[model samples]
Target: MSLSAAVRLRPGPVDLTSVETDAAPGFEGRKADGEAALAAMGAELAELQERLFAEGQSGGRRSVLLVLQGMDTSGKGGTLRHTVGLVDPQGVRITSFKAPTEEERAHDFLWRIERALPLPGILGVFDRSHYEDVLIARVRSLAPPEEIERRYTAINELEQRLVDGGTTVVKCMLHISAAEQKERLLARLDDPTKYWKFNPGDIDERTQWPRYREAYEVALERTHTEAAPWHVVPADKKWFRNLAIGTLLLEALRGLDPQWPAPDFDIDEQRGRLLDEAPIA
Candidate 1:
């Protein structure tokens, strides 16, 4: 099966434990080979993005939203830098959600999210998205059980509106094992450059790994719908993760198949005018 299909989380009950976090299911050969493939895919994605932007310039209504969710050290940042970073920055809107501010807490949980939705013809990325309301809220008891359930329905409805508004949503959960997370965190601690990336709170969060896993399972099952599907990307291997995301993005763009907008002015007339203009020395 294709990497996109292999990593996709289908509708129904999803057991996080059943999924492999370390395996590269749809890729072959060495890490270098995967990186090479990813680079090629990145080029294609850039071209597709240019076309998508141009289509929007010509009054096209479509856009793309890529939502990345994962545990700490699951390589969410790396995916953004290595994969999605290939596209033109002007056409990419990236929002990284941190703790909610006082004003954000005063509003609905999705209010900040709605404000960050990608504009028409741009590719928007959510480093951490609305799923946090269900994940952290459930794991940390930030909201009541009944309220958590309601958020699922609210998320579905919100995504439906986004789809109706010409935005295609692609959500991905980067899955990494506890052992792998430990290694990455330790490496960060040892490397002075990465020391800034470490957080004492991450250690505390790791203690509730089981609860977080269950929260993700519930969120994935509840929100995986026809309008917006979820992809559980294996992220222990960075190369494969990049390749997988690039492939999924490429496919989404391919499906959209955006074209260059038709020229408003007469092509022959413009060509003649250009020819008649003074030649450069």
Candidate 2:
């Protein structure tokens, strides 16, 4: 099965509590094996991404948007550092959404999101995406209940539009158990070098874990559409998380079957022109 299918959340009422955070759903590899596999995939991933970028330059409209949502210290940064880090930086666009600025707050929740979407042929990654309106907003009562309900439908519609316009949306939720999250948070506190990553607000958010889980479940169920489904990666194992997401990216790119664009000019003419002119003083 494709990695997307392996980690995809089935259609039904969602229950995150039942999922295992440490289980490597479809992979049978240990840490070393997973790392080795990712390394092997790097060359192919880079080549495929280059093809996609070239196609975009040649007028292809298709692109990809990877939306990664998770709780604090769920390894969003680490995943990008490892998996996405392997691909050529030129073909990738990454956006990390923080709290809304005043200008962002003035517009619809998706307004800022739309501004960051990938253009044709680029592989775009969202560290925390438009889901925040429904996830954090719902969990913290940041929006009216009625407004929250409306945003879900709006998100589904926007994603469908993106698909119609040739953008593939790959949504993932990095799931780590509460115990695992606590441990990660404590490790950050313990490591002075990671002090900057330590946030007192994250501990405050921990107080509402149950609420957040429910919010995520509802968001996953309501917005998980046929065009853009959600994949739940058990992220306690950092190595496996990287492997699964890396595979997801690989599957997405391969599905597009991006090929090198045909040279607009005659290849023979261009080759002769370049070869004959190369010895200029």
Candidate 3:
């Protein structure tokens, strides 16, 4: 299965309960092979990123935006470290959205997101994004039901504007099972090194798992679009998750097919001038 077919959420009604969180659909490789495959993709991703950067330097208006959303322990950070980490830092812009501060809360929800958008010829990654308003806000009752419903339309419009402005948005939900989440959380609590990742609030959120699932289902169904579709990545297997997302990203960049911009000045003349200049000691 292609990564696109394996995990990209379809339009219309979506039932989160039916999707397998642990399925590694497209990959039949062993663990070591999977790791090696991911490594090879890293090189490809680097080359494509360089082309994208060059295109931007030459005034190209294309860019990519990767939006990641999932429950805690779904490996959003891991995806960044292992998958997106392949790209040049100078060519990528990463943002992690947290709770709205006093100032942020004063404006519309998308105000902060608008400010963080990647420039042309860049790859932008959002650890959590505008969907938070629908997912967390709906589940936690942070906003009214009527307002939450409105945000669904609001998000679509915002993403459409991004697409219109030459941004190709790729959204992924790192789907993981409740059992896997329990094991991961326990491992975190048991390991001294991972204490910082263990949060009491996570437990609080876990208790509302069903509600959050419903929220996710609604958000995916409402917001998944041709312009900015969502991919439901099975993330219980960390290696597979990394491989799958890496593949998706590679596909997106390949689709763009950015080429290295040609030099506007005469290359031969420049080379001759360089050679004729005084040699360094």
Candidate 4:
């Protein structure tokens, strides 16, 4: 089965806690094997991204948007460094959402999201997304209960619209165990080089781990759709997380079947023109 089909959460209630954070769901290999697989995908991944980028510049309307959601130290950053790194930077547009500014808050929750969408042919990745309006808002009571409820429907509609507009939406929830998260947090504290990465607020967030898990369950259940289903990637092992996401992205790109656009101009004429032209130098 395709990785997309394998990791996709079915439309219904979900139990995030039930997923094994260290297990590689569809993959049968160990860490070394996973790393090797990811390495092998590098060339094709780069080629596809370049084709997709070229297609966009050639007036193709299709694009891709990868939505990655997870808790602290769930390897969102690592995905960027490893999985996403396989593709050319020119083809990718990344957005790391933070607490909204007053300007952003003044508008609807998705207002900023609309602006962050990847242009045609580009791959857009969101570290955290409008789901925050539902996840964090619900957990922290940052918005009215009814408002949070309304955002779920809005998110679904927006994703569907994006699909109709030729953007393939790939959503992945990096699932990490609480114990693993604690260890990762402690590792940061133990390393002087990683001290800057440490966040006291993350520990505060940990205090509400149960609430956050419940919030994620609700968000996944309510917003998961055929238009853009959520993939629960096992993230405790960095190698598996990178390999899975890389495979997922490669599959999505291949599904688009993006190809090099035929030259719009006459190749023979351009070649002759180039040969006849005098060098300015």
Candidate 5:
């Protein structure tokens, strides 16, 4: 299947013009066996993550940056929780960007993001990222129109720089419908345990869904590039979401072909020395 076709299968807020996927073999619509696909992909990701960990430990000079952006209650946190759990904790780092603090605001938009970039031999996941400058800033009217426009160019340049420097960036925008979001918010409100997840601001933002959608449309159009293309994952089905994201990540990691580093010395010689030093059993 083509990239466009694959995207059509998943649910997420997307600007089709911004989407560029070369023909790739995959399911285009909702897979009837999505649950099974997810389970299989989850297993594959687990195995690949181990390989990435080993390679990174061996001084492998590669890194991965997984960026997750979506509306409130779109399952970004839940996705991170399950997806990151499949990787070696020591080899992965997760950063959740909330409202900016005075310190964060002091720096340029990408400064906080740059500081969070994964070091060689690790995977870094940004819960919400630099995209906020476009998404939130545009919706909330936090910046001048000129400043907002400038950020789009600046962000594209920054991501391109990272890609050129050996960072493999997998950017995913979780697409959930407004109606679905409303349902999720209501679920959170009604469930006592999930009540903590509710915030009045969420409802306030819902009223501006169309505005935010337009903001995302522009954000995706301006920033999606060959170097760091965005993938819109269908988030309405949490299981399918996990599977799709996990599959994409596993594919990227496996494609890198990371392997364990060779031992520094002869294993036989080391074993012999240990045997000679030991007392009779």
Candidate 6:
């Protein structure tokens, strides 16, 4: 089945243009049956990733860029920890971008991200990427309105250029509701061991959920394009979110059809001789 058919994504009522400010229904925690579906999807994704890795080795060309952007506690780390665990690490790389360091801040925003792009025959995953410039900057009023708008346009063009240069871009926005986020935050606060996960600043951000929603809507609508479309995965149910993301990633990699490079010299005769002499040990 097509990825869309498998997930059965319902269109949000707010038009794409209005996604930033729109509060769509987030996926409730999965039902019991969702667990089985998630397992099946995980297996399928593993198989697909293996095939893509083999093809990537053969083709000796082509790479994939998977950009995962989400609000805090949207399961970005969990999804990466699980989904990527199924792939051959030698063929994949994950980069987590935090608040820029002094050196990173010295360069253009894309510079840090650009440096992390995948080489040929590999998959690169970006956790909280250049999109933060739009999402967080807008939320905190860090940049002027004119600058924010310009960055959005620049991001689209940059992604377009990457696609034109042979990097298939698969971007995902993990979607969760305010209530679910609250539950997660509270869970962290109530558990002594989980205290490290809670940030005092998170409380401040929670107050601005509505504004962040607006920021995301605008970001998604403006950034969504034919070359690099965004998949807004339902993240309230961690299992379903992972399943959907893994399914989408597997499909994208499968579509690439990477193949191993051809041998430079004939090996048939040498292989026959080696087989005949193999018992000489």
TM-score of candidate 4 to 2 decimals:
0.97
Which ranges of candidate 1 are over 4 A from the true structure? 273-281
Per-residue alpha-carbon lDDT of candidate 4 for residues 221-250, written as tens digits (9 for 90 to 100): 998889988899989999988988998899
Provide the clash count, candidate 1: 0
* lDDT, candidate 3, at 83: 92
Candidate 2's displacement at residue 236, Å, is 0.5
Estimate every model's Cα lDDT from 0 to 1. Answer: 0.92, 0.94, 0.92, 0.92, 0.79, 0.76
Per-residue lDDT of 141-257 in model 5, one digit per residue for the tens?
Answer: 999999999999999899999888778888888888777898999999889999989999899998998898899888887787878887777677776677667777876788777
lDDT per residue for candidate 1 within 69-155, as digits (tens), equals 999999889999999989999899999999899999899999999999998899999999999999999999998999999999999
Pairs that clash in candidate 3 = none
Model 5 weakest lDDT span, ten residues long: 16-25
The all-Cα superposition gives candidate 5 an RMSD in Å to the true structure of 4.2
Provide the clashing-pair count of each candidate structure: 0, 0, 0, 0, 4, 13
- Which ten-residue region of model 2 has the weakest summed lDDT? 1-10
Consecutive 10-residue window with the lowest summed lDDT within model 4:
1-10
Worst-scoring 10-residue span by lDDT in model 1: 21-30
Best by lDDT: 2
Instruction: Tally clashes: model 6.
Output: 13
How close to the true structure is residue 130 of candidate 6, measured as C-alpha lDDT? 94
231-271: candidate 2 lDDT, tens digit per residue: 99999999989999999999899999999998889989988
Deviation from native of the Cα of residue 185 in model 5, angstroms: 0.6
TM-score for all predictions? 0.96, 0.97, 0.97, 0.97, 0.88, 0.84
Off by over 4 Å in 6: 1-32, 41-44, 54-59, 272-281
Candidate 5: residue 193 Cα off by (Å): 0.7
